[model samples]
Target: MSYGKKEFRKRLLILTVLISLSFLVLLGRLWVLEIIQGEKYLFLARNNSIRLLPSRAPRGIIYDRKGEILARSRPSFSITIYPWNLSQEDLAETVKEISPIIGVKEERIYQTIEESQSPFNNIPLKEDVDLKTATKILERKLSLAGVDLQVQPRRYYPDEELLAPVLGYLGEIDKDQLQALRGRGYRLGDRVGRDGVERVYDEYLKGEDGGWQIRVNNRGQRVGTMGHKEPLPGNDLVLTIDRQLQQVAWDSLKGRPGAIVVLDPNNGEILSLVSAPAYDPNLFAGSLSQEKWLSLKGDPLHPLTNRAIQGEYPPGSAFKVITTIAALERGIASRDKSFFCSGTFPFKDRVFKCWKEEGCGTLNLKEAIIHSCNVYFYQLGLETGVDNIVDFSKEFGLGKASGIDLVEEKKGLLPHRRWRKESLSRKWFDGDTINLSIGQGYLLVTPLQMANLIGAIANGGRLYRPYLVKRIISPEGETIRETRPRLIKEVILKKKNLDLLRESLFGVVNEKGPSGRRTGTGWRAKIEGIEVAGKTGTAENPLGEDHAWFIGFAPYREPKIALAILVEHGGMGGKAAAPIAKRIFEAYFNSKVGEKKSRKVEE
Candidate 1:
């Protein structure tokens, strides 16, 4: 009995030690939870009770130089569901009830909820909801336990297709963009700029989004407002574009496949820019339908393309100006140098034919430019050589991007001997030089580049960087930034040479029946009150008819506007493009006169 008592006491002592160790372990875990990991657990617990809801700030408004609104925001309603607040059965019931009303599939709603990154955050079931549907959802709020109607700002374009390419459009941030931008406070449902000025200046246009903390019950229903922060609106942009001039340029295209660019030669301020086959940007304001999106993407005309800076084509006879500058600069040709054109140029074994079959007899440099004599330029190019031509073309901003503020600008091709040897694996030949001299073979330029080049000539050899936005204003009406005229380069030329070239260009438009011809090539560009100097080009295209081109500046003396027009597959520049230039010049000068009269009246 004594031994049994001893063994029982020993077992009891062991059991007591085991119980103490278990209690100590429990106390250790409790300390870790209450102290070491306290903040984390506390945050998780707070999140369960208080939900942070993000609110989108209004995007900046875009305006023309005259303060006309181009882009703004409108109040829109959206239906969203808080997945964490609803049980599986409640979510099913809500989806069944709201799907038919919202015109969305029940499966889609369920998928949205399932794919949501955060169950506590609201998942948008349907955006851009109609008022009647929103009213119905509100009335049935008790039945739809986790669903709520929220008002948000949606982008709205006033003029629609008028400024579609320049203003661009916004869409929901994609997964990749979300991943890249999440650290910057961007969310899945946030809209982001996709093209043009919107994409380029998104940082300034996208305002800081705000958020609200609200106390919620276990059911995910808001019980009270805990805290809130107001969203900061984005800054406004004032463009140098004149709405009237933009409209005129768009209208002058006349639904043709072409582009027109007008600029203030002195300041590089873009007055008007238009690319044909434009689409309504409003189509992208809301969720674009698959059919509509496909139609635009599949259209053969490529309406989405901004052709002014993107299209690459041979400048044709318009490039003669560069050739002339090259020759004059190299002292290979002069205003008095004469070349006889017998309708064809014989280089080695091949003969290149001129457009004028009978040949333009004996012609001086100025007369050649006026008549667009191919043979004359061919000789001049041979004399100037390929290297000199390429150098001068580069100096004229040809075969290069004009550094416009727009995106996707193509640097046109300027073929040289090295490029030929490397790219084509062939030595540069005389035929190649002759062809490039006339801007026919392997030489290409964007209309923007041509406009900038002409702008340089009109502004006395000063090349300015083409810019669209003139100023940026803060929400509080303070000037945040203003764009000043930026000179890019200077074309070094004697004043006499420029004057001579300018005079020759003036004759191409103003002088008629010169050199015993019926009319000058650019005679159709003449305006009664405006003395316009211009160049006409018929670019040969391998696919179809020649592309028409015209580059010019108005009021030959103290020119203010420099313009470039391109029409795809148009027959002749003199016949097709020059006439368009005349109309634009007329409208521009007429508007200037009216503005002057208005100012006088005010005075």
Candidate 2:
């Protein structure tokens, strides 16, 4: 009996120890679950069966001068697929089913399904699809594996007819852009701004995209909205252009190819920049048809080119003003500095003839510019010398870029001794300087440069850098920054010399004297009651027809507006380009708004 009791007590002790150890393990597991990995496990548990959804931010709006909507976004349907939620076996069937319905190849679908990584709810099948097509896809029950349809926003151009080139176009994000913005919260399918306002203000234009998480089935379906970061809407852009003026400029082009640059002489704000052969930028929002893209790309007029800033041409006689400035500053020519114009200058085995067959005898500096005398400047150029001419030209913002707030601005050619030697492998000569004086032979400049030059002369010999953006505003319409009327440089010439040159420019419009002979089209084209001072240009193009240019400032007493008009392959500058200027002037001064706000032109 004693031995049995001892064995029983030992068994009881062992049992008691086993029970205590089991309780300890249960407590340890509870502690770990409650403290160490509670949140992580909870997230994992929900995520295993839930779907994370992303809400794309709405794009910004573009408004013109009068608060008219130029560009906006509209609702559309996008087809997407979730790669992580679907099984690898289902990927193949998904491809087979989606291919026939969407007319997409099964191979491409399979590749996307097989290659995608991470928890992505949107695997785009076709973005920017038509609403009708979207409805058909949904009703057809052609739902490919892992595919879901959702609402997507796309860009729309309301006034595409008015502004096209100024707005520019957007295109697909290639590997280059993708690589640049790889992990900076921008993904492969994000539609970035490719050009114009979109490209210039891409960060502000593309608002932050947001998302949420929800419990989903193993079949990869959205069950509910989880954690959401609401996407911030992009700021609306308000431009500095009058819609009426823009429309008139567009209508005036009348199918001929040309460019117009209009700016406020006081602040150098680009009021309007018009390029002909423009197209609706809406064509680029989605998948552009191959035919439409080819037509636009191969258009004869090169509609895509912003000619105001990019096109380079010889300034012709229009360059005489720069020559005059150089002459005045160098003391090579003065108000009464006389040089005979025999209509032609003798070159090496070549004689260049002036447009006016009649010779100009003993012309003063002012008279020389008024008559567009070729020989006078030819003689003045020799006195000024090539080096001095180049130096003075640099002071007026020639040979260098204006640093305008746009893309692809050309630095027009102003060849010097070094440029001639480096580029042409030839030495500079006297003939080159003479040619440069007349704005010919390697002295090319864009219309913007011409306008800026005129603006400088009008604003007391001080050059201001040209800019398109006057200021940028925040979403709440608060000015983030305002541009000041900045002057770049001033040419230090005797006041008398500056006065004489200004008087000569005034003669071109106000006086019909012997000095101001109507040689180019600018003579016949003049607006009544408006004393517009201008210079006409006709440049010989090596590739095609001659390029005609006209640059001037209006209401000569106090210069308020400066404009540059360029017509490619058109006739004389005075006839072809001057009429365009007349229309632009009419649009400005005749408008009731302008007349009411017409401030006296300041000297």
Candidate 3:
């Protein structure tokens, strides 16, 4: 407790050194935090209060050929929360108060905020909320901190289920999609195209998104806008589709489980495409319920399936056209050559019977096609062989993808000798050839393929790749891209043979037989003033009634519209499918005439 003067001086100096070292340590730590990690800490400090809020851009306007709008976007309201601005107590209170009004559980709201990777960014609590609910939240804004109402662009399909399979729909981005698209500015809770043209042209349809840097108070109430950017609208799509023709085709189906395709034969421009039992794309504009999703997946008819390109079926008597082509091209059968039929043909150990029990008696190549005689084709197919038939079918773009500008197109089954050995582990038999000749065996084709086949026949052996989109226009009304007729292949055949075949097809619709006792199979599709050529098919089905089909092109000399119509579980192609084709042709020609008259009046 007592010290001399020298001892006191020594203690004071030691105290001074210890104080200086403590200050030096403090200065070193401050230098590291401020100089070494200054930018990182500065960003963290700015993000704590100032946040970037994204503004959704409106999707492009989808238009028919005549400039009729099919799809557009409308303004909608959504509820969001800023978890970074709220304490634990404030967040709980906010969730509890708004949960009942928004029809969401408080636990879900809490879980959504807690699971977010970017708590600084606003998280949507409920999307596409009704105006009444939004109004209630606005009225209680002071009581609910960190809860805000914002406007978002929501997709709207004006025609509802009419063009769903073609236009597709939008959905929230999943984890996989976000990971794949993150580099392209996609983030959590972003919406993207799911299928159809929407998925195919997403880059052109999805415009640039805008955003704002806004300053918010502790309660998450926006106090000031630091910066803002306006969003750009997506480009417009001009499709080759004719809205009136589409309506007519849909009505002809009458909500059946089938498809109808109408296109320009010379150019492959699709005028109408209808797939029945379609779902509403509007249902997917907002959040879809799990129960409804499961119901759609479990439906027996599969409304989600695009029957035009995806459905594969036996082509029935329609295969006779291919058989006839093969026979003529290979010089196996002449135009006047005839075969006798007594209802059935016995080959090996089996008897293949004609559809008509009484039989077609005697018929030539043209008569056989017009009458759709099974026994006549059975004999012709045996003579022509399977290899020739397959080669001709491929030339006509059958048993392969039609190269259409659409998704999920199926290359139908084209059976040959090797296919049977590989798939069924059996030898190719005469019975198989007989069945294939009538389009009743392993040979499968889509309605789209049948339509394309008829188109090639009508266009004089030039196979054009079918296309739905004609042009893409910018938002300022400038044409950015236009699609022309793309010729896929041109079959090499004698002009006389093609002309004779065309004449025979013309008879199948207009010509009467044996003093009007029996008409050609496609006579029901006949138009009084227009020359139409078509074929009929009745595909066999073990589970139910046979599937009916008709393929036709009108104004036979200079054809305008080619069509393929199918009716699932509908008996007789002439009775069920031919009438529908007639109606479609009528509507199409009538519209053309109306356009001409309007142009004349304007002139």
TM per candidate comes to: 0.90, 0.82, 0.92
Better of 1 and 2 by lDDT: 1
Pairs with steric clashes in candidate 1:
none
Candidate 1 regions off by >4 Å? 1-49, 174-188, 216-219, 289-294, 514-518
Candidate 1's TM-score reads 0.90
Better of 1 and 2 by TM-score: 1
The per-residue C-alpha lDDT of model 1 at residue 143 equals: 81
Q: What's model 3's lDDT at 487?
A: 91
Error of 1 at 397 (Å): 1.5
Predicted candidate 1 versus true structure: per-residue lDDT over 528-547, tens digit per residue? 97889999999999999999
RMSD of each predicted structure: 4.2, 8.4, 4.2
**How high is the CA lDDT of each candidate model?**
0.87, 0.75, 0.88
Q: Would you list the rank order by TM-score, best first? A: 3, 1, 2
lDDT per residue as tens, model 3, 184-284: 87778777889778877877888888988887777777777899898888888888889989999998888888899899999999898888888999989
lDDT of 1 at 359: 97
